[model samples]
Target: MKGTNYPNRWLIALAGIVMQICLGTVYGWSVFTKPLMAAHNWSNSEVTLTFTIAIGCLAISSAAGGYILDTKGARIVATIGGILFGLGTLITGYGDQIGSLTVIYIGYGLVCGLGLGFGYITPIATLVKWFPDKRGLITGLAVMGFGLGSLMLTMLSPGMIASMGTAMTFYIFGGIFLVAVTGAAQLMVEPPVDYVPAGWMSPIGKKSSDGMTLGQAVGSKYFYLLWTMLFLNITAGIALISQASPMAQELMPSTMSVGEKAMQAGVILGLFAIVNGLGRLLWASVSDKIGRRTVFIILFSTQAVAFYFLAGTKDMMMFTIICSYIYACYGGGFSTMPAYAADIFGTKYVGRIYGWMLTAWGAAGIMGPMLFSRIRQASGNYSEALIITAVGLAIALVLPLLAVPSKAKSKDAKVA
Candidate 1:
């Protein structure tokens, strides 16, 4: 490590945040849902499927992208992801102009989803290696942009749609995304071998030690527990997210015009997006002081209570408070999980390990939105779906209690 002149690590972190902010706009899918539905005469379930497919593809792509990132490097993968995402968005706009739902799905759901996966994993995996000394805080900071990306798009999308129309808006955003994401990705690179921050010592007195491989990690009970916990948390949180705008509007008095309702819902959605981003930074940093498992426990317990209140709330103010809390905990799970996996499986293979763990995200993306949409369509309200998510969260609370940390070894990991 001597004589090495490292690029400023903080700049790498900045680049990662910028890329994530672009990728994170997928969370703003709900903002486009009603418009798309009205434009295409698609049902809620049909429109929601675009988001589901994008996320499903994101999980699959990220799983594969992790290996490429670990072996080939972060810059290439992120750049490719950026290109794919921007291209996909452009394609979606073109598909809209032609009125083809299938084309839109391919553009947004499949193409953009793949891009999201590749772009998303690059930062977390790369930053984990660069900042082992501040694993929790750094990973949190890296992903905080992703959480906030939704807010940026949410605030901008409505006005943009009103002024330019959805397709043109998508076209413009696509160009911006292409420029922004790839530009930032150019700044990303892996640290040198055996890199360490100046003045910091590894508590173990080694540059690096043996860590669990992807196979070894998958063999452990810890992996399964973490995966299931993530699944449950995402399932509950995303159910609301997929429908947040319309659901908020549903609670409004009938006297309000459609535009007014959309504006109010946009405001609430914007607030949720803000807390979602902040929660990542707040909870992940807190996990450094407490423990990762303890942080997850807190997230689960508090979110469970919030969901219980959310199931029946009709008052807009009360509804906002409850959803914001749930959003925080939901975002916390994401930021905390990377650190948690690093602690259990070791940072060496966390890219692969955590990438695979995101399959839970794919599954939840499909399950949460589909289930929420179906229940709403059938029952004419979100109450039943909200209650179901509450119960799921309550059950998930037990998984963290069972998740005890274990040491990573060069040999195959045990079921502990």
Candidate 2:
């Protein structure tokens, strides 16, 4: 295979960063909801349902986006994603203008969700190809941008809404995302032909543990174990995030003004993003030194503990600390998974395999929030909902211990 090195690897990573930043705006949906409700006089559940639609779209589109990325290459898929995302935002603004809930669901939920699915996949695939030697670290860095991007929007979007109004805010944010994501798409390229990282050899080239190719890996039990692990982690985290403001209100009913409650929620959410972003890097890098399986064990166990404690505590400081730790595990889980897949399955079809694995995320998107909201509605409190989340986390923690590493098919399996 002929190698091409026209675009620098760091530049590729930067492009991934840009793509994630745009994609991460979904995390800022909460900031828009209250304002939207005040302006339109919509019910809280009605406004919150918009987010549910967006997340549902994100899940469904992720599967399709993965297939597209594998077949068409990252550039075209991501460019399309950028366009869809921009249009979705623009349409969402129009939806707001018309007070049409359906338009918001279709435009922001379906279209932008499709865009997010495509945009999210490209960076993961590209970064893996570029940094084969440091798959975990590279994946961590690229995905950490996704986590941190939420922090950025959490800080910026509220002020933008205050000054510019909801429709204008969407228009501006959409345009900015379009420009940034489009430019990032232009910078994306597949890795060099027949290129191998320095001081590294293919697992097939050396004698080591046999592992499956991407195709074979998916068929194995370990794949499902990893899948379940991610599903549980994301479900818990999303549930917490979806109800963040309400949770804060419940905790500090007397002291917090509505604005203060929202601000505090924003702070907690931002802190989650920060810790989540940093945890991706920190945990994935640690996986390199300590081993992936070991790291998974630690993360899952810690997450279980955190979730258990989160259910009992209404203390703001304690809540923040516990949730932050949980977010770290959430972020770390995402960053580590690609490398984990690469470790077990070769990069031959890492993108597709990873995409398939992300079905866990999509499925969890539905289960987590649905479970939280439904249970809260039925029980008239969040405590029962949280306890259920803790149970889910505990269930997730068991999967890693039972996980069997992918077997090597050839010497190439060892190097990966």
Candidate 3:
């Protein structure tokens, strides 16, 4: 497979990168919020709801998309996702012009969100198959693009808004995303039979504790433990992300210009994207060496400390570092879980099983932001919300230690 004649492994990784770039643009939501609010004279809560709706749609669509990817292959699933996402954004731009927040929510939230869900899963299973030996690293690299995609957009969207206005910016991004993703989708193909890359040991042949099939994996104690961990991790991260701008205001109130504030927010979000992207690869690759369980323990435990510090820190430098570390943990969690799933369950049905697991993220998506936002609204401060998030992370640290890999036998177990 590494014959240097259009290396298929790299090609597949490239496709994963492209797919993630499109998905990451949505992660750049914070960059758009101020502009959207200033232009439409809408309240903060109303604008924030759009993100909530989009995240909910992403969660539902991801589950469905996983099932489809298992059956239909990457090309079809991604192509359709691109088309839907593009159309959704096009309509969202029109909705923006007319000041129809409802239309924007439905189009960008539901339609584009579905596209993100569908597109997000295709690369995971494909990359797993492509580099069975380096599953963690490959998976991390692919998903890291999703995190970095926002960095690219964060840099571009502001200039685009300045030059072309927000509505036209959407149209431009919608078209560019459609073309890039569609082209990348075309490059994706399933791995061939008995395909083990050069010098790579097959995971199937490894002797370890017995594992479960996808079905049994879902039924095991450890599966739920992993799910709980993910839920806590996501909840903490989303709580911070959803309230970042407002939190900045409270911490630095009356000292910064509007332009300075916007710049600060953009810098924070951009750093989150960069750190998050780096974390996906960094932690996942580390897992390959130290084992997934150790990494999870470190991630959750460190994040608990970070979140606590984030709530108390008033210094800009300290605040930025803490926020970046938190973002890294969030992104690392997303990348690590699939490989973790493979470690516990055999990879035969990983696509479908991982999809099912992502529902935890979906649940957290709803709970995290709402919890923090509502608490902030009620108390006029985020200190309590931060404390709650820190507690959740601490709890997550313990769940992984309790998880014992499933010992059930399955028909698929004999194939290796």
The global C-alpha lDDT for each of the candidates, from Candidate 1 onward, is 0.87, 0.76, 0.78
Please report the candidate that would top TM-score against the real structure: 1
lDDT of 2 by residue, 52-134 (tens): 77777776666677677767788987898888888899999989878888898888888898888888888897788778778
Q: List TM-score per model, in order.
A: 0.96, 0.91, 0.92
What does candidate 1's lDDT look like per residue over 144-222, in tens digits?
A: 8998999988998888887888899899999999999999999889886678888777655335333589999999898
Ranking by TM-score: 1, 3, 2
lDDT of 3 by residue, 342-413 (tens): 766755666677777777877877787788778877887788888888887887767767764443222222
Task: Output the TM-score of candidate 1.
Answer: 0.96
Candidate 2's C-alpha runs over 4 A off are 1-6, 204-215, 253-256, 406-416
- lDDT at 208, model 3: 27
Q: Summing lDDT over every window of 10 consecutive residues in candidate 1, give the lowest-scoring window.
A: 407-416
Our tally of clashes for model 2 stands at: 12
- For model 2, the run of ten residues with the poorest summed lDDT: 407-416
